[model samples]
Target chain A: MQEKQKPYAYAKSLELFARAAAVIPEGIYGHQNPAFVLPGACPYFADRAQGGHFWDVDGNQYIDFQCGYGPVVLGHNHPEVEDAVREQMAKGSCFNHPTRLMVDLAERLTSLIPAADWAAFAKNGSDVTTWAIRIAREYTGREKIVMARGAYHGAHAWCTAYPGGVLDDEKKHILSMRWNRLDDLENLADGHKDRIAGIILTPYHHPTYAAQEMPAGGFWEGVRKICDREGIVLIVDDIRACFRLDVRCSPHYFNIDPDILCVAKAMANGHPISAAMGRKNFRESAEAVFFAGTFWSSPAPMAAALKTLSILESTDAIPKMERLGRKLKTGLEELGQKHGFRVTASGPAALPYLTFDDDPDLYHIQAFSRHMISRGIFLHPHHNWFICAAHTDEDIDYTLETADEVFPEVRKEMES
Target chain B: MDEILRASLFLKAVLPLMEDLVDFDTIAASAISDKRLILQFEVKNGPSSHLRIEGGKIRHGIGMHQSPDIRLTFKKPELLNRMFDGEDVRPGLRKGFFHLLFLIREFPKLAERLQYYLEGDGKKAVDEKTKNFQVRIGLHAMLGGMATVASDDASLRSIADETPFGTLLVRILPDGPFGTFTKLSHNGGYIFESTFNQPVRHANAVMEFAGPDAAKKLIDGALNAVTAIGLGQEIKIRGLLPLIDKASIFLYRFGKIMGV
Candidate 1:
């Protein structure tokens, strides 16, 4: 049995957290909240991050698998992307007028993404997703939108996870259907008919804290058929799963084409940029819709995106991430067998979520995550962990070794 | 004049317009046809007068209805007039003259219809351009009112105080129709600065929405701010996660006081 690791010290983090809590509600909000993670295990603040690694304010180094909540696709501070950003920053980061890099990035995306003939840029995933919906509504002259029941397209009123501040009237135009249930989507499209503007979905079902479910066989085809027959726009929100699954697009990886594609998160290797790409049919309507942001045309992020895309296209980043993820998954499974536990890992090899078979309240998974954190590896208990291109074979070997050591501890905690 | 007389006079002046704006089809669709809302008037030194609205019609009488589903009490007729005049009624809420109670879920739609009747183009109160101007002015006032309320309200102050020192810039898009943005800074207290130009420093959070209409919908609670953020509809937010939540809460609180 491996010796029990010392409790991760968080004195500086705790002090910072106290100061943050006094000045900020809940200290850190959204998915980063300490409540979401093992409360006393993870650091509240990060000091710096580089390839496949980040350090906490308390000087604790972690082999990061969370990848800044799915943004750091290549790695933190990727040299190429940073160089591009630096070059653009010297010229000017943003301007009163649009920069040439915006056009370059847009052209690059349209060429790379199969369904994209035209593209529009925005700052976040929500911006592009909402723009897609608005364009769909404008194009179809329809009010109703259909979406997967639990799919989070973005954090707007039409599809927010939380509805505390939303109005019924705002949501009146929106409808929901079960993911991977073609019949449910067909029924809605048939029932709503020409009133339906669009049907938006992720390439796969990856709801939070749950095992991800790929689309049922022929589910995407059926959805495409329904949207085509019903004259409804098909939107793919590939914000989280983009680039990791495939270089072209997640939909392309699954052998399907969406009418509108929303891409962000990993697109620029942690840069703040999202794109709404659409077929030629949506060009007129997309132009008709009023969408503009003060910083949307910024050159630095666009240049970083251009460089990130170039690296992804030229390198074996995606394949490497997937391979490393598989190694981690296979290693954990072997450790689970050795420790008399059933570890289940799901989703794409690149984006994996781990859980114990019988862990309902996620106690075992939490213990496992705490152990991982203590051993200098960072993986989320309730969220899908990302594998970046920067994770090397040595990193994978070390992670597997740590996992092998921690499995017995996890089993002991579970038994206790 | 006595409170009852004042209330009765205002009710008589506004009831016809309110009735015209009712949209019974919407109410019926809302499944609130059976529900009754009591407009209770707590007059100063006078007998209270109440109007019961149910089944898509308004009936005037006191103690005629039992167990009102929603109750809106007005202490002064002037406050009621201010609401009718499309002025910010948040001050009334702060001053304790106006109060509303109902299912929090139902409040948004109710607020929407009430606003349509109150500030909406009722029998051509003003020309199209003037109406547009008034809408813009109203939005500015609401933004300004939020800053005022944030400064005074203890809960809001605590939220501001607790928020990691940062500034939230809310930019209303489409420079022509409603060209303004409000910057909310939380260092120790809160400071709200409204301007058209971009701020010098990168704000902790930036919430962008399409136009005044979208902004109004959000302010009046017809549009869900989080949903807007999610759907990318007319709104977008980018910032520190905690600051985003704090800014959302601050906006929601402001909306609540505005009777949205």
Candidate 2:
């Protein structure tokens, strides 16, 4: 194909969509996104990717904060990853049964992660989380699992329709609790006792506007105590925050090891793979659950995962990422402070969520998203940002510099 | 500064749909203007007043207040920038920051018009370059048909005399999907409900609607109508502003032009 500048740029994406929509549903793979939420349309195609930048077929480049919805950890198409995948591809991507590499993977993971006495794999986060629930159901023989209010577990039919609707089907086997709050959870927990199988949380709330806030004042420890007392399996849905928090062994970071921990995104370098690492108690039950996919055990992704984890651990990826994240965060805070607007940026080192301090309209999200899109950056008005290993000091500087320039303009649009 | 000019132009393009919904001519005649191009629209129920500028200065036209109504406050440049910048003025008024208050009963029709107005201007949008030129919709209802230009320059290279329906004001759009624009004779003209295809490029055109009822009727018909014809040339609608009813009216007009 002919070379262009940035592929994720909006205009070019639209051009590709004008053609692709003719064939695919909504013109791309998967469900429609906020990009298609507007009266207008989302861009159609991604032309190329390298490191922290991606280009659209129309030749617009962006610093890629979207990070493919939190998966491109080592940056887009790292050469090492590609080389590994290429080499693995030469030997074939998969074999029907468990590969010898799986043994190595499970063994290494058991050693590297504190809570991962046993491990299992799937193609996406949803699979692992769902498996955890299955294990919970079988282990305790409980009919229901407790989910934090607004927590997003995955794309399963049960996970998608959890909140805000009069849902009867998915709500079963899933009791609910509020994140970052001990009282709400304890109140709900008292009523459930042994009927509750597991409490799935995001380390932050999953679905609402208030998602991405960390657990405040030992909330996690309290919840852990509650789960331990009640014999409820605690499942941390770290799929979203896994590598970004610099916690290779995140279950230990908060010093609360849930019985089962599920992680995906940034694990296999944009490759579709998710692993649910657990304590020794539930490994056999997890393996027996009907959690299998034809594309699950690809050697390419296996090799990619091994390489990605190696780099993240070897180069101290999380620390370097945190430095850049701090720079971006500091700049955003300063911009909000300077504008005298209620603006704040929070969340982890890799992904940051910025919003107006007090009053936030969805329009700010839309306006900022479009403003950045037109400027060749794609900002989702919906959720937290995904910062990848590819992001550099220069990239953070440029992004912060852009914020300094644009914040005043956005302020003009604010109510005050 | 975001160009308010682009906002105005976008408003003009969508206004045909609004006109189809409400009798804008009746509403326009009802509103007392300062008799200048700086038109101000005082919506009835809604808490918004729209002002139009012609010579880069706000004089008086749509709903301008010489005493500078706080019921219609003016931050002057800041307000203008925000409007063009795509800010919603409704909440501003609610918060006492926009400071313009209107009794819901006082400006009901005008409220609809205000929504149309804001929807067009796009408070926070940057100006985009239009690919097509402009066209005019001739108004035959008053003064033996006033020729309205879709853009400042209204020109048609070719128009299809025969529509699928009846004797109608068939405007040949500048460009369309098939690289052609057709002004088809239909069951109804700009007043009747119809459909039109959206062109890739912006086009300016003049429309000719007979009466207020025709405009409103055209809007209602188009809402239920499911037809679309393509604009063959670069054409855009101009000389129109957002009127709540105007948005509904444009839907039909756009629908009819595209064979809706």
Candidate 3:
């Protein structure tokens, strides 16, 4: 039977899957992680990858939107990057002693991002964000840290805990202020001026659910002037959105520079790495700042990141993304209109979002996300999709085709 | 625990670990006086749940009646099947399988309570409750999970003697997270934080409330402003507490003139 054969063709995957279940939880790598790729299950495994694509052991070729989740801007196994790695392999990758590459990387970052003059590195974003907070306390002799309402900086308890339960009373140093609410910003800075250490915000905006409503009017400018006036340090976490958007996803994007700014993701293209950059004056504080790690300073990411930056310097990487972002947005909106839905897209990054008008009963956004997944184009089911540079125009067209088909079906369902 | 709830059928907590289940016949014979509420479901055994409200308290009653102010039923087989299958209750509501049959107007308050009880803490109900609280947080009329609270151990002991929120949460104190937070103002300016898995009727999306604490604060803040403690007057109180996730407490004000 076709059904039996279809499963039997998948029988090899199935047997491994069953064996995995006997030893592992639900037979998966990540708990609660579902595989939404071809064969429509959690991926059994991947064999190898190259040039904008990868395959599982089953030999399925698909465009990689999973992009190691926002790090594969240059795609899998880029030759120049691979070459950099091979060369670095000849030189010792990491030493407890300082390397010329660290300073070289810092100088390169300071030139690209306005606020990043002196820099520190972390294995991941959470470390740098936490370091930024500590630096804020050091820079200003204050205790409290304020975050924009609904913004996520990292998984640290300070950031993780928001609203009520996220931070218990004991971890009471954090406060939530309206992202663009100038009045709240003014009040917070004014009220806690004497004791407020800093206010950190992710310029990516609309943090929760990635509803990217850009900062409005004089909100950022007002906060900029307020933080200075109140002596509050400003920390910008641009880790995930850095190379995806622009190095200018920093305060420079909003015409202001932060006291400290952190960057990671896409810098190494699927290698686990992140960097923190701050003003020159904060450089002295960095000597006292004690963030340590083993794998963070590993050679693979260092080599990969060196190559990533080289390619970025060579090409108009951010500008090319801007054009592609615009193209994707225009296409998605047009498709949404034709298919009878509303779409929200932002920035010229690999990730642009396509969402419907807000409706409670009909979570059209969720439905659309599920639809995109059912097709080969797997995206983060979100309002703002992270678009990697690897996604070709053909990929976007296929996604559009799927959207066109899905919308009419959805509309019919809504009518019934 | 409040005096009334302690007096009610709240003794199961003290039994030895192995002797978990309670003998309802013994509890009913000791606690009841005249009648019982009918269990309408053919499975849970009908006409079994009964209680009498007097002076402002609820207690078990003798005998069984087909009709009562409140009657809740469960199909034993269906419940067992669901339990055995480990089918989570929240999804079943979203799928629209369960039904609550009732006469809407016969007992208004109790019907509303039953609605809250049955839908309990499903996602939709808890979400609705959360939305309601979020939108109306600044207002004192509805609970916003933020209550103005005060800690007067003596007052909490005396005042929350009958309220359900006070009843279950009164005595057993948690050493971590929430400890001795069993007091709330009935209509107080109170603030507390809670999150429901999903909004279900009477299911708390966010549990923090400024119930009795707010009530007391408002009344004490300006007693001349508080004349009649009725529907819109705001009953500033002692403390009313919140029940945990899987458990719920039943609190009913007494007499025809109670809520008003």
Per-residue lDDT value at B51 in model 2 = 39
Give the DockQ (2 decimals) of all models: 0.02, 0.02, 0.03
Question: What is the C-alpha lDDT profile of model 1 across B1-260, one tens digit per residue?
Answer: 22333343344322322333344326522634555666554334333345566786655443323544334555665666564444555322222122243333343455456555346554555554444444454454444344434443443443455444455566667663332223345565456443323343545445667776687576445665543443334666543344445545654554454444
- Report lDDT per candidate: 0.71, 0.54, 0.50
Residues A180-211 of candidate 1: C-alpha lDDT, one tens digit per residue: 88888878877887899998899998876567
Which residue runs of candidate 3 sit more than 4 Å off their true CA positions?
Answer: A1-32, A35-49, A54-62, A90-94, A162-170, A247-249, A347-349, A360-362, A413-416, B1-260
Docking class of 1: incorrect
What TM-score does chain A of model 2 get?
0.91
| lDDT of model 2, residue A235 | 87
Give a tens-digit lDDT track for model 3, residues A1-416: 00111111233444555565556644654212232222233234566876556655665444555666567777788778888777776787777765666666667776777777777676778888888888888878788998876576777667752222342542577777776787887787777767888888877574433456677877777888888888888888777677766655546656666888877778887777788888888877766768788766666676787778777667777666667667768887888888767766654345665546643222355455545544444554432455565656776666666667777766766567
Model 2 quality (TM-score): 0.61
The model with the greater TM-score, 1 or 3, is 1
Candidate 2 lDDT, A1-416, residue by residue in tens: 21223223355555555455555543553333222222232344577888888876766777788788888987998999889889988988767776776777778777888878988777888888888898988888887787765567877766763122324555555666666778877887788767888888876653434326766878888989988888888888889878676545556655666788898888878988889998888877776677778888777788888888888888867887777878887887887688676666777756787766553324454455555555656565556777877788878877766666566766666455
Give stretches of model 2 more than 4 Å off: A1-9, A29-44, A162-167, A206-211, A414-416, B1-260
The candidate that wins on lDDT is 1
Task: Tell the DockQ for candidate 2.
Answer: 0.02
| Cα error of candidate 3 at position B30, Å | 12
